[model samples]
Target: MRRLLLVTCSALGLLALLPVNGALAVELPVRKAGLWEMKVLSGGSVPEMTMQQCTDETTDKDMSTAMSPVAKEICSKQDIQKTATGYVTDSVCGVAGMTIKSKAEINGDFNSAYTVKTSSHTEGGMGGAPRDSSSTIEAKWIGACKSDQKPGDIMMPGGMKMNINDMQKLKALIPKQPAK
Candidate 1:
């Protein structure tokens, strides 16, 4: 379950890299400021998980790190191409003994709805059990947030509610780099 979550989160981060302009700038495509729901389907191993997220331009910018600063140390290659309708990206990333090569496509409108599909191949990990998987995520705007839900808040799977910023702690869990 945790592995799935990590992959899902990383995929979303990569999708967020879709450029708002042709220069492949740092800005993510703009979406309305409100509550949005994302339903993720991962090869049927994990049941669909629907989570609501509060979004605004600033929040989106903060969450959308196609590649985190530290991630650069691990990801050796990245290529992104803008298309008439959406964007396509391919990247190679490594973490410890695992390395992954992935490609993704995003289509539809960011303001109202969009779909993201990603496929990846993982080598040198998971007991050598041929690691390959695909996932689809559909996100739609859902108007105002619940009264109790604040911006940057997300209701994750397992009925767990957490502020998106809290996810930063996961960065700490990454193994430290050996002496440079």
Candidate 2:
């Protein structure tokens, strides 16, 4: 469930980067340097959880695309429009024979707080059944990072800390595979 929310948040992060003019270019509002708390609620099927992250300017920007390994690989095209309240996006993407059509509406000031509501439908999913889901995420600034926490450090729901930027280090932690 947590992983699902994280992935949803990743999509929202991409949405946040949309230009105010509705351009596809990534232009994210600068969130203040501090600790942030995000609460995610995805359908009744998943439990709600609040996760905190510490960020600085660089970290905040990097986080926007952390989960987006390849935009073109996933989304064929994404259309974003600025709404009176926040922004809206209509996206289409496909992977592994699964096609996803999604729409998202975001509200609130990204500098301090914001909420994203999203609904998506997937066809040809793992179970070969059409899947429809909706999720809401609320995030707000929560003062400074803790003494032990630094920029780019994310504290997952299970109390595990990770620096996503240090992929090499994480890879090092995994034992190498033996030759066939």
User: What shift in Å separates residue 51 of candidate 1 from its native position after superposition?
Assistant: 1.4
Give the local distance difference test score of model 1: 0.67
Q: What lDDT is reached at residue 111 by model 2?
A: 69
Q: Per-residue lDDT tens digits of candidate 1, residues 12-131?
A: 445334332333443337778899988877785566767788878877766645335545555555667778878787766665556677787888788888888888887875556558
**Each prediction's TM-score versus the true structure:** 0.79, 0.75
C-alpha RMSD by candidate, in order? 3.7, 6.4
- Candidate 2 stretches greater than 4 Å from native: 1-26, 65-69, 166-180
Which residue window of length 10 is worst by lDDT in model 2?
171-180
Candidate closest to the true structure, highest TM-score: 1
